[model samples]
Target: MFRNGYKMKPIIATLAGLMLIVALACAGESATPTSKPTNTPAPVATATSAPAATVPAGATATEVPVPAEGPELTSMETYMQSSGYMPEWGEPKTGGIFKWRVSRNNSNFSPNMSGTTHGLFNMPRYGSLIRFDPWVGFTSIIPDLAKSWAWNDDMTTLTFQLYEGVKFQNIPEVPESYNGGKVRGDEFTCEDVGPSAERHVRPPKWETTLKKGQRSLWHLTGVTCPDGPLGYTAEVHFEVPLGKTMSALAQGLMVMLDKDWLEWYNTEHPAGMTKGTNEAYHLGMGTGPYIPGEFKSDIVGEHRRNPDYHRDGLPLADGIDVVILKDFTTAFTALATGQIHVMGRGSWSMTPAQVAQAQRDFPDRITVHPNAHLFGYGVGFNVGRAPYDNPKVRQAVQLAMDRDEWLLLRDAGELPGGMKMLALVSGTPWSYSVEELEQMRGIRDKLTPGGQEDVAEANALLDEVFGEGNRELEISCMAAGVEYVEDCLLFADMMKKNLGIKVVMESVEPAVGTDRSKTGAYEMNSGAVAASTDFGDPDDYLLPKISTRYNANSSAVLRNLEALKVNEPELMLWLEDTIDKQSRELDFVKRHAMVRELENKIYYDLALYIPFGQRMAFPGTGPAVKGYRLFDLSLYSNWSIWERVWLDE
Candidate 1:
């Protein structure tokens, strides 16, 4: 792997510009508004009108077009300047089917209750109040559904002015009985924010189902529409300071659900229906650029462009045809053919070797764009189980890990060192620099003496714990996807060879694996295979992930995590409280030091969670997909950029 001289992407500021100062200042005196509504449409493709997307010779555009009033959407122009657009992409042309892929099916259409396959399905139809600027660094917070926002002198209080006349999709799916005879296509307003926020953090069935919503918006203490239901002003109060609040808002993670729709849903399914199994589960009503259409689990999903969408000159393609391909080899084959225009996401979608091979073989057809990756994977042990209950056994597993081999396996047998190095934005207080990480004990080349020394020490620890030649463990290898099995097998082999222990494996479905983790029924496995977040904020990644409790796309990887809730209540509560102290710490220098120390002590010291390291991702797309920018600083943040992408050919 020779350097073609590709530089690593710049580190995104953890707090995102003078936000730390602004938040602290608010404690003393009132602060000014951060952004205001303005007329600023994007320059790219404003001159050209998108022609009707070409369909089959006889097949016409399925939906009727709702012509724009003037030239473009008034609401759309106000925030376009915040996002970056490429000059080389030239004039945008519209009206073509944007074919894509997702590795698996979404559990449901609701972002609140659905399983996390957000990029492909849920997000295209819904939006958040604020968002990170598309095609730029993650530092800037831009308006989405909101026109502008301000922070009061009190750190907890915030206010928002929303875009007026924003209307939900006007589909005939909603019946008059559902919302007191009001059509579902009515205007979206500030009053809707209250109910949407309530469902997000405090859903009705607290213990039974739908917890991902709570994880996404845990900071907010209250959200309200000061005026009646149709008012455009929203008042919000969060328990934390600026860092935690902005991270939750800027990622488009909270897709504002329709208030009337929620009332209807509660009336119909009192106990909350099982995730997406029923016929009514597929329905969607949103203010975003697309409308949900046909879907078949683990097969395909269709999103038709919303003709009445408020965003002007957006969603250049007529629709997106999403095909689910679970296997990487199969996905590559589809990419080589004309089956799909691009891979589903840039992060962890393909290896560097695959991208290079595609360039050499299909340069004329495929164009791969570079992206920064923040996601990593590794083994998570259930500490409530036997030998794993002993801290020595957990420490031995991480010490014996051949980290370089894990990277090599992920990189398609080639070591792309110095890319992610088990950390995001290395050299900062959050993690070590690339140079420093390369020489460390666990991360350095295993053939080196230092690496071998770690393995020897690991063996000694295991012997002391299990009384020499009497140690064995069975890992429940989660069958969530093919990669999960591969990572689990590699880890089992490493532990057996390095520490000389007997390892056995059992395969279980994703649903079964989640249950096993919750009840501490499994010894160890790849539970946190894609541990990731939307931004560079330390609190955003640290709190929901390793610090407190993890239960979304990536399961918890810490020892005693599940057991701590019931068995060691006080210890867990004290440790969680201590970890969150960094969030409230205002001083930049002090907070940086606090973040590093907490990470070392809370995450690495106990060896409860082992990281699989990071990677630089390349999203493979067709040359026809124009105006698409390389804005992947965060693993899941850039999916919203699809709004600006248009087709040329």
Candidate 2:
């Protein structure tokens, strides 16, 4: 059973070091493992006696098989243990806060509505029923709020055994605590889980402002907490026999909401504030290891350690202080100046050129995690608008794009190595392969090295659409991030050079970028988005992204699809039935075939989006930063492991 979850953009910037571009190559069923290795020899520190093994940047250490004389390896657990990855660290001593910098200002901590920034901020506070194990390249599942879970024979129903004593945050200062009856925190129960599950599908009208809530709740029919052998047992019934039910419930979509608190909040607050309410942002409680302490819009969001955490020896740090910056250069400067302890993956945090510069400047402090991210940059067209509404023009733009050139310019003329992705979601069985992608139009003969420009094809398409040489395009992008700004400029130049289009690149503030995207205010927009394959399934990518009604990005072609579904009932029915069957299909081989078929239709046949290279998350930390690692390459799930991190200095 596998399912990929709806993915948003990778952290908007690279926080500390150089952004190393690592190519993804499939090995069996698992996604490529992301490794962060230092460039120089192991630093001599008195913290431990043994020196840590250093795998070169952009390389995975081959797992050597046990000798014939030794016992055969059984599972990944044994392999990882023997591979020296499970090194014993000295006893953890917790005290200091880990200062981290995020590129974008977090709007709010609302689970369903928030983007990457808000998601990361909420991670230390929230808990899910099931979670992707980061140590295993997210190939395995681990318990979170739910202690144990199982699916019935037909896979239509999932039963969860919750941890009986877990409690929500008890921050008395928050307004939601004034819900009269209890001045203290409430116990996390199936009552909370059932209402949260129901709320996932039946979001309030205000939820329309939240980008990805109801759209992700597909297949889930109802959640019940009936009397069972074990108390606090919850059964989640699905409309279809979903193979990736566990994976689907592992992301921000499945965070258990405090139903009582929400009801009280709605009663007290007006609809205006309740739509994107600050009360829900700050007052929301969870069963995790931290509670949100302070929030200064667009500047900082801080969290204090949860004193009444369920886990033993949790939240090694005193607190986490996240500084919100607009761009990566500032973040990089802060990391260098010792203002921040770690700089994570962000849209603008680390550019390829900056990475090269960082290696030259701070070789000892920098480390690169290659092929760790699941999202990438793409050129989105508003199909509802003119000129771009034409498929030929879209194809022309895709064909004219010199990906190889962009790679060179983006990475300072160096190929840092990355695989071409046919679909938005890579690192999974359903992701389109090179040979398969090569067979598609616009991509057939447009590769690197000796590939010629497709100016003729592009011009012909434009000529047919808007006569000869009348092609013009306006692009919308954030002005803060260097990578995004440069990409817009590069694409604009390419459009003019190849298609004879007059390109207009409009740079807006971070908030304005979101507003523009929602309004479909540009002919094209460019940026990288991060998505995760929580269960190695195709539904994650197709459902939230391709469906116009599912995503808040206001995808031009996707929005058109919603209109098409209304106008063309037969096509909608066929699509709905095909996608549902694909989701329920238990056979991996058959499901993969169906996934590839749909991807071909979406990418090649429709050409709604022009997929750029897949994203790579480079997590860089200071010398004294200990136990800081990216377990799951997700916005919310990665920060969940922050509790395990501690500061050495």
Candidate 3:
């Protein structure tokens, strides 16, 4: 049986360093790994130094044969071993604030209601059952709230043995009901499990409550917490292989909310010093390293260390203060002047030039982590819309998208991280090798002769599809944030110049961007997705991203898929089935093969999203900012890292 349990575990702003830009040498590295919590737990991750693991940043993979039987790898030993990604940020110190920056702020603090940007700014306040290790090889796992877990003989029923005496934060100032008169609620017990498992982010039936749970499709049938909210153990039952259940639990999307907190939130009673702040934050709490402090919807949000936290020796810093810098240039200035201790530790907070500048100008004042990060970002097409609905049209647009040009235009084609392949594989064990990508059409080096041939083919496809007169049509494009708006402009220019499509670009608020994307309200939009953000499961990202199901395809987030389904029924069914098969396959090697038939590749064939402006997080950190790294590409999970970081100053 394939049953196992294991634990583990941007932004450019400046153009200050000309010489450093030319020679982006390795900063430094160590292998100490993340600090372990005596109380809290770990997450779902990649296999070990085991062969198929580690798809080098800009290199190809070395294939290994799969074993026919025996036991598959579990997460138990994944965290101890380092993938040589650790940074020697000095000994851990205590008591200082981690001042970080974001392009925007989050409003709705609810799990299912929030967007990616929300995680970027406030994820540290949330804790999951399992969390991505804050140290190296984020693709692997460790424990978080879950003390340990196990699957049955067929790998269907999963159970979690909870850590005892884990108490929820007690901010008497924030509650929605007339219960618990201004005191810490109760210990996180078994009763919290039933409501969490019964209601989640995934879709079909449960989706009605949480419409966008990591984008559609699930295998969980029921969850039975026998002892209710008072006990510790929780039993969950699934209809198929334990897929969505694992990712959802580990990703923090489905958290074990305090039973009383849920009651107050559901009943709608109010408490707290400030009504708005309480509603957005304290109303729902968790067993995390930090507590939500003073919050300004757009300007800033403060996270205070949880003194009564369940985890011991955690939250090395006293707190985290996340502020917003409208654009990359402004954010870089903040980092340079030490206005913020770290920028973009969670999201693409800065630019490549700024990273080089920070290290060059403030060599001792700042610490630049030159390694770790693979961003899958670009422009997503709404396939449910006409013209975009046509596969040939989609393919043509993708063919014309010059990934190399995007790099040049966006980051001057020079990144300290080097030229990295994004999207499709996203630096995962199951990702296509650089060698294989070189042979593909939409990907591959755009400066080469083969690339020119691909462009010629794209023009031919466009000619065949649009004829001549209607070639120049108009389309609306949108994106959120200053960086994304810039990305939108570059993509719009490329599409107009190459595909003869006139584009209108708009930079909307972050919330608007998500709602529009979720509803397919635009023709194209700036996009990025961390396939491993939720969990290292293909089902976590793929199904909702590319599925033909109405409102399921997040890349398109189209309203009606009836047109695409009618036109390509076989392809749609196969894509859906393949996604399902991969989710069910527990063996690493076999599942890798199924993830990509690799012949046509879904990203290229479906052409719903064309990845351009690829990025490797170039986060700039002040000297005092130590023990910090992106929890995941999209900054959606691993908020637990806050527990490991300490402000050296």
Question: What TM-score do all the candidates reach, one by one?
Answer: 0.75, 0.74, 0.75
lDDT (Cα, tens digit) per residue for candidate 3, span 1-649: 1122231002233323422332222121121212221221111112121122543111111211111221243322222233423446555677877777777766545544434456644456556666555553334445666766676667667777676777777675555334753225467767776565544644224223355453532556666776664566777777766333454555566666665665565556332211235345655576677888877765677788887776555667888777755666566556655667876643455555555454444455455554334356777677677888789887887787777666565441124343335345344455555566667776666578888777778778878887854667677778776767877787778777666777788889988887876777777777564223344445545655555543455443434344556777788778777776766666655666776672245666766667663455556677667666543242445555667777766
Candidate 1 weakest lDDT stretch, 10 residues: 2-11
Model 3 scores a C-alpha lDDT of 0.57
lDDT of 1 by residue, 427-452 (tens): 22345555766676566667889988
For model 2, state the Cα shift of residue 459 in Å: 7.2
Report the candidate with higher TM-score, 2 versus 3: 3
Overall local distance difference test of candidate 1: 0.59
Model 1, residue 513: distance off in Å is 3.9
Q: What TM-score does candidate 1 reach?
A: 0.75
